[model samples]
Target: MVEDEFATEPFEVAWAGEARWFLQFLSEGAGEVSVRTQVSADGLVWVDHESPALSGPMRGVMTVPVSDFGHWLRLVVTPSSGDPSSLARVYLALKE
Candidate 1:
Protein backbone atom coordinates (compact mmCIF):
# COMPACT_ATOMS: atom_id res chain seq x y z
CA MET A 1 0.00 0.00 0.00
CA VAL A 2 1.11 3.57 -0.65
CA GLU A 3 1.36 5.99 2.22
CA ASP A 4 0.13 9.15 0.55
CA GLU A 5 2.01 12.39 1.27
CA PHE A 6 3.41 15.44 -0.44
CA ALA A 7 7.08 15.44 -1.38
CA THR A 8 8.76 18.47 0.13
CA GLU A 9 12.25 17.01 -0.12
CA PRO A 10 14.11 14.14 -1.74
CA PHE A 11 12.39 10.90 -0.90
CA GLU A 12 14.81 8.08 -0.06
CA VAL A 13 14.63 4.32 0.01
CA ALA A 14 17.06 1.68 1.18
CA TRP A 15 18.18 -0.87 -1.38
CA ALA A 16 17.53 -4.37 -0.12
CA GLY A 17 18.91 -6.22 -3.14
CA GLU A 18 15.84 -5.44 -5.15
CA ALA A 19 16.37 -5.68 -8.87
CA ARG A 20 13.89 -2.94 -9.69
CA TRP A 21 11.78 -0.21 -8.14
CA PHE A 22 8.59 1.54 -9.15
CA LEU A 23 7.73 5.14 -8.41
CA GLN A 24 4.32 6.71 -8.84
CA PHE A 25 3.51 10.38 -8.65
CA LEU A 26 0.14 12.10 -8.51
CA SER A 27 -0.17 15.82 -8.73
CA GLU A 28 -2.99 18.16 -7.72
CA GLY A 29 -2.01 21.20 -9.73
CA ALA A 30 -0.86 21.89 -13.25
CA GLY A 31 2.86 22.44 -13.68
CA GLU A 32 6.12 21.01 -14.89
CA VAL A 33 7.73 18.52 -12.56
CA SER A 34 11.02 16.71 -12.83
CA VAL A 35 11.93 13.62 -10.90
CA ARG A 36 15.42 12.21 -11.04
CA THR A 37 16.82 9.05 -9.56
CA GLN A 38 19.85 9.36 -7.32
CA VAL A 39 22.02 6.78 -5.63
CA SER A 40 24.51 6.87 -2.75
CA ALA A 41 26.61 4.28 -1.03
CA ASP A 42 26.87 6.03 2.32
CA GLY A 43 23.64 7.95 1.99
CA LEU A 44 25.59 11.21 2.45
CA VAL A 45 26.84 11.80 -1.08
CA TRP A 46 24.42 11.14 -3.94
CA VAL A 47 24.78 11.00 -7.69
CA ASP A 48 22.21 10.94 -10.42
CA HIS A 49 21.63 7.42 -11.65
CA GLU A 50 20.17 8.45 -14.96
CA SER A 51 18.89 11.42 -16.84
CA PRO A 52 15.73 13.01 -15.50
CA ALA A 53 13.57 9.94 -15.07
CA LEU A 54 10.35 11.85 -15.36
CA SER A 55 9.56 15.39 -16.44
CA GLY A 56 6.60 17.49 -17.55
CA PRO A 57 3.36 16.60 -15.84
CA MET A 58 3.93 15.35 -12.28
CA ARG A 59 1.67 12.37 -12.66
CA GLY A 60 3.10 9.08 -13.92
CA VAL A 61 4.89 5.88 -13.03
CA MET A 62 8.61 5.19 -13.46
CA THR A 63 10.53 1.96 -13.36
CA VAL A 64 14.12 2.03 -12.14
CA PRO A 65 16.63 -0.79 -12.36
CA VAL A 66 19.18 -1.26 -9.56
CA SER A 67 21.90 -3.05 -11.49
CA ASP A 68 24.49 -0.30 -11.13
CA PHE A 69 22.92 1.63 -8.31
CA GLY A 70 24.26 2.07 -4.79
CA HIS A 71 22.87 0.77 -1.54
CA TRP A 72 20.56 3.77 -1.27
CA LEU A 73 18.19 5.39 -3.69
CA ARG A 74 16.11 8.55 -3.76
CA LEU A 75 13.95 10.76 -5.94
CA VAL A 76 14.90 14.41 -6.35
CA VAL A 77 11.90 16.41 -7.44
CA THR A 78 11.93 19.83 -9.05
CA PRO A 79 8.64 21.54 -9.73
CA SER A 80 8.06 24.59 -11.86
CA SER A 81 4.97 26.76 -11.91
CA GLY A 82 3.76 25.25 -8.68
CA ASP A 83 4.73 25.01 -5.04
CA PRO A 84 5.28 22.05 -2.82
CA SER A 85 1.55 21.94 -2.21
CA SER A 86 1.10 20.93 -5.84
CA LEU A 87 2.14 17.38 -5.12
CA ALA A 88 -0.74 15.25 -3.98
CA ARG A 89 0.74 11.83 -3.31
CA VAL A 90 3.77 9.62 -4.01
CA TYR A 91 4.20 5.86 -3.93
CA LEU A 92 7.17 3.51 -4.21
CA ALA A 93 7.40 -0.23 -4.64
CA LEU A 94 10.22 -2.77 -4.93
CA LYS A 95 10.59 -5.86 -7.07
CA GLU A 96 13.04 -8.66 -6.74
Candidate 2:
Protein backbone atom coordinates (compact mmCIF):
# COMPACT_ATOMS: atom_id res chain seq x y z
CA MET A 1 0.00 0.00 0.00
CA VAL A 2 1.17 3.53 -0.70
CA GLU A 3 2.59 5.01 2.43
CA ASP A 4 3.05 8.54 3.69
CA GLU A 5 6.48 10.09 3.81
CA PHE A 6 8.75 8.36 6.28
CA ALA A 7 12.33 8.26 7.44
CA THR A 8 14.58 5.55 8.79
CA GLU A 9 16.02 5.78 12.25
CA PRO A 10 19.26 7.70 12.52
CA PHE A 11 22.26 5.37 12.29
CA GLU A 12 25.66 6.26 13.63
CA VAL A 13 28.41 5.51 11.14
CA ALA A 14 31.22 7.89 11.93
CA TRP A 15 33.81 5.16 11.59
CA ALA A 16 32.88 4.13 8.09
CA GLY A 17 34.53 5.75 5.10
CA GLU A 18 31.74 5.00 2.71
CA ALA A 19 28.13 3.86 2.75
CA ARG A 20 25.72 2.39 0.24
CA TRP A 21 21.97 2.14 0.31
CA PHE A 22 20.17 -0.68 -1.46
CA LEU A 23 16.55 -0.03 -2.27
CA GLN A 24 14.70 -3.03 -3.57
CA PHE A 25 11.18 -2.87 -4.81
CA LEU A 26 9.38 -6.18 -4.58
CA SER A 27 5.99 -4.88 -5.61
CA GLU A 28 4.42 -1.56 -6.56
CA GLY A 29 1.05 0.00 -7.11
CA ALA A 30 0.78 3.32 -8.91
CA GLY A 31 3.77 5.49 -9.71
CA GLU A 32 6.99 4.84 -7.80
CA VAL A 33 8.74 5.44 -4.49
CA SER A 34 11.49 8.03 -4.26
CA VAL A 35 14.37 7.87 -1.80
CA ARG A 36 16.73 10.50 -0.52
CA THR A 37 19.90 9.99 1.47
CA GLN A 38 20.11 12.23 4.50
CA VAL A 39 22.78 13.11 7.00
CA SER A 40 22.79 14.38 10.57
CA ALA A 41 25.20 15.41 13.26
CA ASP A 42 23.30 14.90 16.54
CA GLY A 43 21.01 12.24 15.03
CA LEU A 44 18.05 14.37 15.92
CA VAL A 45 17.77 16.49 12.76
CA TRP A 46 18.58 15.76 9.12
CA VAL A 47 19.26 17.28 5.73
CA ASP A 48 19.45 15.85 2.24
CA HIS A 49 22.67 14.73 0.69
CA GLU A 50 24.09 16.25 -2.47
CA SER A 51 23.26 13.26 -4.65
CA PRO A 52 20.12 13.36 -6.67
CA ALA A 53 16.93 11.66 -5.53
CA LEU A 54 16.29 8.12 -6.72
CA SER A 55 13.33 5.87 -7.38
CA GLY A 56 12.72 2.23 -8.25
CA PRO A 57 10.13 0.48 -10.33
CA MET A 58 8.22 -2.64 -9.37
CA ARG A 59 10.59 -5.60 -9.00
CA GLY A 60 13.56 -3.33 -9.55
CA VAL A 61 16.39 -2.24 -7.34
CA MET A 62 18.30 1.01 -6.93
CA THR A 63 21.52 1.79 -5.11
CA VAL A 64 22.94 5.04 -3.75
CA PRO A 65 26.36 5.75 -2.32
CA VAL A 66 27.27 8.49 0.14
CA SER A 67 30.48 9.81 1.58
CA ASP A 68 31.76 12.90 3.40
CA PHE A 69 28.83 12.63 5.76
CA GLY A 70 29.07 13.41 9.44
CA HIS A 71 28.32 11.03 12.30
CA TRP A 72 24.79 10.00 11.40
CA LEU A 73 22.95 8.76 8.32
CA ARG A 74 19.44 7.77 7.28
CA LEU A 75 17.07 7.59 4.36
CA VAL A 76 13.94 9.62 3.80
CA VAL A 77 11.38 7.80 1.71
CA THR A 78 8.42 9.48 0.11
CA PRO A 79 5.48 8.01 -1.81
CA SER A 80 4.04 11.16 -3.26
CA SER A 81 4.39 12.73 -6.75
CA GLY A 82 1.97 10.14 -8.14
CA ASP A 83 4.24 7.36 -6.99
CA PRO A 84 4.16 3.84 -5.66
CA SER A 85 2.27 1.84 -3.06
CA SER A 86 3.98 -1.00 -1.11
CA LEU A 87 6.55 -3.75 -0.56
CA ALA A 88 9.93 -2.04 -0.65
CA ARG A 89 13.00 -2.91 1.37
CA VAL A 90 16.09 -0.90 2.30
CA TYR A 91 19.56 -2.07 3.19
CA LEU A 92 22.69 -0.21 4.18
CA ALA A 93 26.25 -1.31 3.48
CA LEU A 94 29.20 0.36 5.08
CA LYS A 95 32.88 -0.07 4.34
CA GLU A 96 36.06 1.35 5.65
Candidate 3:
Protein backbone atom coordinates (compact mmCIF):
# COMPACT_ATOMS: atom_id res chain seq x y z
CA MET A 1 0.00 0.00 0.00
CA VAL A 2 1.14 3.52 -0.64
CA GLU A 3 1.74 5.55 2.47
CA ASP A 4 3.79 8.46 1.32
CA GLU A 5 2.93 10.76 -1.54
CA PHE A 6 4.00 9.88 -5.08
CA ALA A 7 5.40 12.00 -7.86
CA THR A 8 6.16 10.96 -11.41
CA GLU A 9 9.32 11.79 -13.28
CA PRO A 10 9.41 15.19 -14.93
CA PHE A 11 8.49 15.14 -18.60
CA GLU A 12 9.31 17.69 -21.26
CA VAL A 13 6.27 17.91 -23.52
CA ALA A 14 7.01 20.68 -25.94
CA TRP A 15 5.97 18.76 -29.05
CA ALA A 16 3.15 16.61 -27.79
CA GLY A 17 -0.25 17.49 -29.11
CA GLU A 18 -2.18 16.18 -26.16
CA ALA A 19 -1.50 14.82 -22.71
CA ARG A 20 -3.53 12.70 -20.30
CA TRP A 21 -2.84 10.97 -17.04
CA PHE A 22 -4.34 7.64 -16.04
CA LEU A 23 -4.40 6.64 -12.40
CA GLN A 24 -5.41 3.18 -11.28
CA PHE A 25 -5.79 1.29 -8.06
CA LEU A 26 -5.29 -2.46 -8.09
CA SER A 27 -7.45 -3.30 -5.10
CA GLU A 28 -10.68 -2.17 -3.49
CA GLY A 29 -9.39 -2.39 0.01
CA ALA A 30 -7.60 0.90 -0.17
CA GLY A 31 -9.52 4.13 0.07
CA GLU A 32 -9.82 6.82 -2.55
CA VAL A 33 -6.81 8.31 -4.28
CA SER A 34 -6.37 11.77 -5.70
CA VAL A 35 -4.17 13.12 -8.44
CA ARG A 36 -3.11 16.62 -9.35
CA THR A 37 -1.88 17.69 -12.77
CA GLN A 38 1.06 19.97 -12.35
CA VAL A 39 3.27 21.97 -14.69
CA SER A 40 6.74 23.39 -14.35
CA ALA A 41 8.94 25.81 -16.18
CA ASP A 42 12.26 24.43 -14.85
CA GLY A 43 11.12 20.94 -13.85
CA LEU A 44 11.59 21.89 -10.19
CA VAL A 45 9.00 24.48 -9.28
CA TRP A 46 5.54 23.13 -10.01
CA VAL A 47 2.05 24.54 -9.89
CA ASP A 48 -1.35 23.04 -10.40
CA HIS A 49 -2.96 23.15 -13.79
CA GLU A 50 -6.36 24.63 -14.50
CA SER A 51 -7.86 21.16 -14.75
CA PRO A 52 -9.74 19.90 -11.75
CA ALA A 53 -7.99 17.56 -9.36
CA LEU A 54 -8.80 13.86 -9.79
CA SER A 55 -10.23 11.82 -6.93
CA GLY A 56 -12.43 8.73 -6.88
CA PRO A 57 -12.91 5.12 -5.79
CA MET A 58 -9.94 2.91 -5.14
CA ARG A 59 -10.77 0.10 -7.54
CA GLY A 60 -11.14 1.98 -10.79
CA VAL A 61 -9.17 4.26 -13.04
CA MET A 62 -9.39 8.02 -13.16
CA THR A 63 -8.08 10.16 -15.98
CA VAL A 64 -7.09 13.82 -16.16
CA PRO A 65 -6.41 15.82 -19.29
CA VAL A 66 -3.72 18.47 -19.48
CA SER A 67 -3.27 21.46 -21.74
CA ASP A 68 -1.55 24.84 -21.82
CA PHE A 69 0.96 23.30 -19.43
CA GLY A 70 4.05 24.96 -20.71
CA HIS A 71 6.98 22.60 -21.48
CA TRP A 72 7.20 20.48 -18.32
CA LEU A 73 4.62 18.17 -16.80
CA ARG A 74 4.22 15.70 -13.98
CA LEU A 75 1.70 14.14 -11.58
CA VAL A 76 1.36 14.25 -7.83
CA VAL A 77 -0.49 11.38 -6.17
CA THR A 78 -1.90 11.08 -2.71
CA PRO A 79 -4.58 9.35 -0.70
CA SER A 80 -7.86 11.15 -0.94
CA SER A 81 -8.86 9.95 2.49
CA GLY A 82 -9.14 6.88 4.71
CA ASP A 83 -6.58 4.15 4.00
CA PRO A 84 -3.75 4.66 1.60
CA SER A 85 -3.58 3.07 -1.81
CA SER A 86 -3.32 -0.72 -1.64
CA LEU A 87 -1.72 -0.76 -5.05
CA ALA A 88 -1.63 2.14 -7.44
CA ARG A 89 -0.18 3.09 -10.75
CA VAL A 90 -0.04 6.32 -12.71
CA TYR A 91 0.46 6.49 -16.44
CA LEU A 92 0.95 9.48 -18.70
CA ALA A 93 -0.17 9.47 -22.32
CA LEU A 94 1.01 11.94 -24.88
CA LYS A 95 -0.40 12.39 -28.34
CA GLU A 96 1.60 13.38 -31.39
Winner by lDDT: 3
Candidate 2 versus the native: TM-score? Answer: 0.86
TM-score to true structure, per model: 0.60, 0.86, 0.88
Clashing residue pairs for model 1: none
Clashes of each: 0, 3, 0
Query: Which TM-score value belongs to model 3?
Result: 0.88
What would the per-residue lDDT of candidate 2 be over residues 15-92, giving only the tens digit for each residue?
999999987777755666678999987998788988888875544777899989878999988775554666778889
Q: Judging by TM-score, tell me the better candidate of 1 and 3.
A: 3
| Residues 1-71 of candidate 3: C-alpha lDDT, one tens digit per residue | 55667788899998888999987777674567778888988998988888988777677788898888889
TM-score of 1: 0.60
For candidate 3, the clash count comes to 0
Report the error of model 3 at residue 57, Å: 1.5
